[model samples]
Target: LDGRTVLVTGGAGFIGSHLVDALCEGCDVRVLDDLSTGRRDHVHPEATLFEGDLCDEGVLDAATEDVDVVFHEAANASVARSVAAPRASHRTNATGTLAVLEAARRADARVVAASSTAIYGDPTTVPVTESEPTTPLSPYGVEKLAADHYVRLYADLYGLDTVALRYFNVYGPRQACTDYSSVITTFLEQACSGQPITVEGDGDQRRDFVHVRDVVSANLLAATTDRVGEAYNVGTGDSVSVAELAALVVELTGARSDVVSVDPRPGDITVSRADISKARAELGYEPSVSLREGLTQLVVGD
Candidate 1:
């Protein structure tokens, strides 16, 4: 990554902030974010921050200037939010992605898109692979799948190198502890504050919880690797039920809280895990942190 100028869209968001920090360790990094959901404080001082939306052509051009790689991480992340506001999600996740791709193409920068496991929809298989059929159930999922396809199309038709990383449940420190945020972050915040943990649905719904650190590593690898025009699953390849996750959060934080089950939301999948063989073989990516260890580090903080 040395001497590389990398542009990170949504660089002030949870995963994006971590990615910015990681990129700054060796590369000259620039960040572009609308700050609609991203916090200004999350932006690293080392990064040249452009406070604007990806859909803004001037903003995109400024951010991509002299950039060698682009990491597209901006999106409406919540399925529920997307359900309530499908148009908004499509504008940002789908259209915003096209704008980013155009900027990257203009700059002749390699692109690494932040895709999602939601693209797999309700997977019929235990461990979801990249080759599996993409049957996105929710607007958010469909938007991401479409963006991913655009990435591949651009790579093939326009000669732009692109890679899409289908991230599982990425969670860790700096994750927003808000209503419309990752489950792990939400649970951790509640448990740390000694609040009741709310589990939507039967609590049997499972997810592959990959740490933000590992996800960041995967993003960095994809940026420079030879794996273009392909998608890879970035996860720990392990599944844990929501019930089990809540229990673990309580245990880890030593918080007193009763788990409360609520009605399942729309587009919620019963279970999701990942097959990381493609990432390991192609990008040389492997998760080094266990869930327990990652959770502890997230709670304790460095």
Candidate 2:
């Protein structure tokens, strides 16, 4: 990434900010964010910040100008929020991606866009692959599916160098504990605060949690890999039940919070894990951080 001008949309957000930090030493980085879920303080000191929405043509144009790569990370990432306001989510997640692709196309920049495992919905298989049916259960999943398709379309139709990374449950530092935040963050917060760890629907649902550091590594690889016009699942390829996760969190934090069950939320997948063999073989992507190690860092602020 040296001697490159890279634009990271949503660079003020959790995953994007980490990517920007990694690129700042070798590339001229530009960030475009609306500061909605992301923060101004999260922007790296060396990177230029462009505060705006992704759909704004002027902002997109300015950010992608002379850029070698565009990391499209901005999105309405909450399934519940998308369920409630699908039209708004579509405008941001789906339409926003198209806008970014267009801007990157004009600049002749390679685009690495963020995708989600939600597109698989409730898969019958344990470890879902890229070829799995996109049976999205919610508006969020559908929006991401649309974005993923658009990325491939741009690559095929316009000959744009593009790749879509289908991220699993990504958790790490700087991840806010919001209503839409990851379950790992929520569990950690609850344990630390002496509040009962809430589990939805008996907590049997399983998910593969990948650390943000590994996710960043995958993005970096996607930026330069010769493999284009395709999607790859980025995950540890290992999963654990939510109940087991809560137990582990309790043990890690040494919190006396009781584990309690709650009503199941709609559009929640019962199980999800990634089949990352394609990424491993083609992109040389490997997840180095374990769940315990990543969770420990988050708990202790390492």
Candidate 3:
């Protein structure tokens, strides 16, 4: 990737910032973010930052100019928030993505779009695969599915090289506490701050937690691979319940806060896991971070 001109849309956010870090040294990186959820401080100084929305054609043209590869990572990622504010969800997650695709087509840049497992929407089967029927429950899922379609359509219609990565329960450092914050981030913050953590609906919902670092690796692979008009799952191929995660957090952080049960949030899935066989075979992507080790790292600041 040395000497390549790269653009990351949400480069100020968690996983996007990590992608920027990896691409900054070897390439000329440019970041375009609206600063709605992403922080300005997370971006590196060496990389240029463009403050604007993806729907802004001027911003898109400026950011996509002379770019070789585009990582379209910006989206409204919260399921519950989407349930409450469906229009805003579609605006940013769906239309915003279309705008990005149009810009990529004009600039003739390869794209790696960051998608979500929410597209599966309460999978009836365990370890959901890309072939599973998509029946998204929330507006967020609908928006994601729309964006995924747009990306693939651009690849086929415009002959653009594009790949979509569906990340499951991504968590790690730099994750802020917000409405769409992961359960892991919420629990860690509460436990470390000596506050009780709330677990909704008995905390028995199973989830496949993949670390953010692994997602970054998958994005890098997507950029280099010659694959186009394809979507791959990025996950650890394992499962853990929210109750188990909370218990582990308490044990690791030694927080005195008790785990309390609460009413479940709407649009929350009961169970989720990923079937990552395709990504492994094609991209040689294997998640190196274990849940225990990842939690320990957060506690010890390693």
Candidate 4:
């Protein structure tokens, strides 16, 4: 990242903040965020923060100016929230992405987008790969799929360098504990507070949890590497059920809390795991953090 001008959209968010920290080593970093879900405190001191919406063309222009690379992480990230508010989610996740791509194209910048495993919907297979057909069940998933397609189209038609990373259950420090945040964060917080962890459904649903640090590494690799017009699954390639995750959180936090089973939530996937061979082979990206180690850090703050 040395001597590079990097623009990180949603840089005040959890994963984006981590990415900003990683890129601040001899790199000029700038952040553009609406702060709807992102906090101002999460914005790194080294980064120039632009308080604006991504949908605005003027805001996009200001942020993309002189940027060598763009990390597009801004999005409405909840499945339930998207289901409840489809139009708002589409505007932010789908339309905002198009705006970002246009800005990147105008600036001739290499772009790395934050896609989700939700684009795969409920995977019938064990380990989902980049080649799997997208069958989005939720509006959030549908919007991301559209965003990924737009990224590929921009890469091919407009000759813009774009790479999309389909992240699977990213969790770590600096993650919010709110309803809009990741499930892991919410569970960890509850467990730490000596509260019973709520498991939506039978607790048999699985997810491939990747540490935010690992996800940041993948983004950095994609930004520097020559791989363009492609999408890679950034994950640990290890599936763990929600029951297992709750148990781990309880162990990590030393919180003696019983797991309570609840009714299943809408638009919830039964299982999700990633096959990260493409990321490993192409970008030399590999998840180095274990769930135990990452969860410990989240609980103990090392």
TM-score of each: 0.96, 0.98, 0.97, 0.97
Residue 276 lDDT, candidate 3, scale 0-100: 97
- Note each model's CA RMSD in angstroms: 1.3, 0.9, 1.1, 1.2
Clashes of each: 0, 0, 0, 0
What count of clashes does model 3 give? Answer: 0
Summarize candidate 3's per-residue lDDT along 168-269 as a digit string, tens digits.
889888887775347888999999999998999888899889888889999999999977899998889999999999999999999999999998876678
Identify the leading candidate in terms of lDDT: 2
Q: What ranges in model 1 sit over 4 Å off?
A: 179-181
lDDT of 4 at 136: 90
Reference-based lDDT, residue 241, model 2: 92
Error of 1 at 213 (Å): 0.4
Question: Weakest 10 consecutive residues, lDDT, candidate 1?
Answer: 173-182
Best TM-score among the predictions, by candidate number: 2
The residue-by-residue lDDT of candidate 1 on 227-265, one tens digit each, is: 689999999999899999999999988899888998887
lDDT of 4: 0.90
Write out the backbone clash pairs for model 2: none
lDDT of each: 0.90, 0.94, 0.90, 0.90
> Model 3 scores what on Cα lDDT?
0.90
